[model samples]
Target chain A: MLLLGKNTQKSVLIAGLAACLLAAPAQAEEIWVSNEKDDTISVIDVATMEVIRTLPTGERPRGIVFSHDYSVLYICASDSDTVQVMDPVSGEILHDLPSGEDPEQFVLHPDNRHLYIANEDDAITTVVDVVTRTVVAQIDVGIEPEGMAVSPDGKYVITTSETTNMAHWIDTQTQELVANTLVDSRPRHAEFTKNGTQLWVSAEIGGTLSVFDVETKAKEVTLEFAVKGVHPDRVQPVGFEFTEDEKTAFVALGPANHVAVVNADTYEVEEYILVGRRVWHMAFNADKSLLFTTNGVSGDVTVIDVASRKAIKTIKVGRFPWGAALRP
Target chain B: MFLRTVLALCLSASAATADVSVVIHYLRQDIEQPPVLSNLDPIPEDLGLRGAELALKENTTTGRFLGQTYTMEVTHVPPGGDLPAAARSALALTDLIVLDAPAEALLAVADLPEAANALIFNASAPDDSLRGADCRANLLHSLPSNAMRTDALAQFLVQRRWDDLALIAGTHPDDIAFADALHGSLTKFGLRLRSEKTWAFDADMRRTASQEVPLFTQDLRDHDILLIADEIHDFGRYIAYNTWDPRPVAGSEGLVPVTWSHVVEQWGAAQLQSRFDKLADRPMRSRDYAAWAAVRSIGEAVTRTGSGDTAALRTFLLGPDFELAGFKGRPMSYRNWNGQLRQPIPLVTDRALVAQAPLEGFLHQTSELDTLGQDRPESACTAF
Candidate 1:
């Protein structure tokens, strides 16, 4: 396996050059960014910090998630209504998984057997069996289901319905809706803590992050964003990622162009790290040394040094860069 | 495992049993409406009601998961019927009401003391006065007002550099009101009104054998576009191809400003249009879209607030946190000043979307959507 070593000093050097040039012997680990309008994925080599290649994909590719084994990648081609499986190494189409209509975003089950897809138009969560490449279940959710997350133990699959303004929970075993906790408006993304005790869902328009107790399915805390100079309407929280230690959480504030770093235990926004316009999604390197964010309107990905909490580089990509996934 | 199954079943059953009902108090005056010019398409019989029905189904689909039941009771009353009685009946049934009546009927229902606590959504009436001095505390407007529509058109015309306008208004009172709004918009945008004329065609004259249209529209001078304000749909549709100057037509027809149009296919609107078409067996009109927005707003409030209590729902709606995703590019919320829905107005031609209003560079301190209609400072709504 190719690994991008967490060399802090080397990354600091690469940050100054705007682009990294790697030796020929070093194996390249690539990060894929899905460009929604371009209908392609820009592969950036971690060793070189450059867009090595662009691979064509289905129409309006928005969300991307990798399998546990890292051999296959699933792309949510929203306009095509199919979760496409591609070989991560070769960037070749492997199979077309049967997703519900207008699948916007999805999450892979930890068990490596199933995939939970949020169909934005059909108001349902489509469960696909990975091995069989067939749809196993279709669970009814709220209108415009756009976000999906599975619990740490793979017991519950949470779908955040944007229009319905609720986080709907479904049992993984029975494929039945278990409970629904109302959040704020336009909930775009949901994430479970590493310990599985808390679930954080981001409301894009409501400008707040709602944290819920996993056991009771009740909201425990709500975090609102307020920057010193940023207006209230611009601070839309869309995507979120937790640190490996679970001590810090990074939220992608869409249109505000800032990623808010929140102290996980205290639920306080510690700092706002400015990125690009209309930031959509985020991913971390294998060693958790660096984080990358896809900025839709700016057509670039902002790479942030995890330890320093500073953006290192902004690499230009295709139009409307949406979801990002790192393979090491 | 058996115990867990039993518990899950019990939980599901209990969740499924709870019910919440919403009634669309569709009070329409039962009278023969005057026919428009033959060029325009005939209005649908279930114009506003069908959209509310589709929205009810959509709400119920999500409501089922949340263990809530939503129902719409559409009551049509005759002309000069007991509208207050109809409002009382609907209030007894459901606190949430969607109004599709005229200005007077809307005011009559809103003026009722029994409806003081009830939530009313206006889906049809587009009078600017409703959002001005006559604005009510309990009523929220879903449809765009005449000022908003005209301002939307004005912004688009400014963007296109169509400065000089020839105004032609209809004979109806509603037409005159719309024309007045157009005049306000032209002045606000600093555009030149080259000439103004009122088409004095009565309902019978609209169908006359005489060539009055050509005679009236002939010999217009120094105008970039002909702006018609035939809100009754009487003469606006015919003015497009019949104009002697061969200039473009806009306003009530041609390049019209609308809240929603079938041609709008951006920002995931195609999905909504298809969903509505499948349900209504026709393309969604602006009125239908307005009615749908009203019903969906209530659903969103109930879902977000997680309460069936009307007072709690109203608080959440009037609160700063309320927002609804109506398939537009951004989330829509209510303007607290006048209870008008703050949304981007789409300007469309007959077959394609031209552009959305509150155009680029029209800045506002709070939101760009505020530039399209009455801003907070100029608003006369003192009642909240």
Candidate 2:
């Protein structure tokens, strides 16, 4: 009778959590732009499409991410080699955490206690304690490790090596290399499925997106871009977000100046929305109604309607703007 | 046990006796005769020898399993020496020879009776005729042809959208040939020659100082690029700083096309440059890369084929399967049609090396690298 009661209580708790998640807002409503050359972050009021405020940060701030609670902002200062923690509401830097040399991009751990930084020139990933602002460990990676993403379960971290033409997986707990799988020439960025079953890698030189099975570590499919002579150097599949129903993945192609809408189930490119030159990172609204992309070379931000997959407006920004986050 | 030991001893003795040895006749020509260009640096006597040393190092590290060894016999021929006799002496010693001789001397050596079976490589000349109408079946060109270098420059200019060019030529015969090659490339790439001017060489200074004449008072302002052809190096540097217009310059001087540059630090260049500098006590020039690539090619051939036999090495080198790491980005191979070593060329400026052709974006239908030089469709020579 006591064992039966315990099982009933566990099921009730899971059901309550599921109900809460379903009732939560479906999208992020406001957009935050990290302007690298301007050394400021532009807060866009999504409804009115106006610049709410421009907050100043460190020199050459490039990569950015918001906390899971949407309270703190993390910005990677590439030239400074530090991740600046900021209070998003007050537009103030709360603290600074030392990262590896030339930290280009980073991802948050599932537990929200650790951050993994892809230190570009140092060829290593630096793990930092979020609350303490201390570096816990350094994981040696390949040459020019750039874009990174943590698995959904937070059990592994995947990083792309630009020159070495391989993607490496590291154990989250031990920070040891678990696998070094060759994907394509000049693999740039990686993304994992929502269920953590498969990982998709973009090859800059080979001009193809390679999909690998998470367990077997074998390539399952390759999605080739239609553009020729494009010199896919930076297939930056950055700022990935699912649709309202979690059926589609919106991928931003930096140099190709297009956004690829991919079918989440079939692993096929559904549509490509053209944007400004060197379109980089992207963000979405709270209701999943609008998507904002930072165009690096064109010095603008493209606002796209998620349903139409068409750019509705472009707002001018600072030079070489990259990274975008959203706040409700 | 005693019988087994005796059998082992006999096997070791036979293996030692079966070792193969081959000799390479390195024929070095001293073309520094009277009437030599005064401003140019004298060709170093050990240029080819330095290349041979690097090649030998690579071979010993990777080619020892082939059961063959390489040794060179250098015969330095002064100006007006008996070419046939020198070649015959080299042929008697070794079946393979690397020749650094002038056009006339090359022709004379090619006419030798013993030159038919012996393999000869031209390591110095840039003349395209040696691979064209005057092509010899026995000769292989390790140095790039004049057409190849000009094509490299022309492709770079086209990529940069500099289509209008001002042609500056010198009166020397070699300069004329260089100009012809550049003109052919410009025309082939659809670039317009806005004007052509002659920069007559001055005997007193051994330089082309004709820039003071102001030949481009009207036409110079119209051109998008300045193309200079001064083989003696006297006037090219002056042309760069004193071009009529502020437009970018390309050709022999400004944004020059070269096989290699000391300033190149991309890919595997840093290690090769350091190795060459440590050995030669000076920075490596374009000539050094060509010479180094030639010897390295031989090493690769032997290593890949697992044999140092001259005929076998030659066959493997000429085959499509052979590829050598020439410090360039891609594997270097030979153009089967003309026996030209086809490799990526570097485009350099005075303060910085700007770009490389077969630049990142340019693409060919078959191979992206084919855009850098004469494509197979335009190649005249039929022999592979």
Top candidate, metric lDDT: 1
lDDT tens per residue, model 2, A14-129: 35644665797553256888888888888888887877788998887878887766668889988787899999878999989888777778888777789888887665788888
lDDT of 1 at A201: 95
- DockQ for all models: 0.20, 0.03
List, residue by residue over B1-384, the lDDT tens digit for candidate 1.
Answer: 011121122122212344555454555544457777574477787888878888888788767666677877788887768878888988887778898888888999998888998889999988999999999999999998989999999998898899998999888888999899999999999998988888877574655523566667686668999998888887676677677777888888788989999999855587788778978899999889999998888877776655778788777887777787776666688998889998889989989888887777677787788887787898999979
What's the fnat for candidate 2, on a 0 to 1 scale? 0.00
Q: Please, what is the TM-score per model?
A: 0.84, 0.64
Give per-residue CA lDDT, model 1, range A301-321, as digits (tens).
Answer: 999998999999999999999
| Cα-based lDDT for every prediction | 0.81, 0.69
Q: Comparing to the true complex, what docking class would candidate 2 get?
A: incorrect
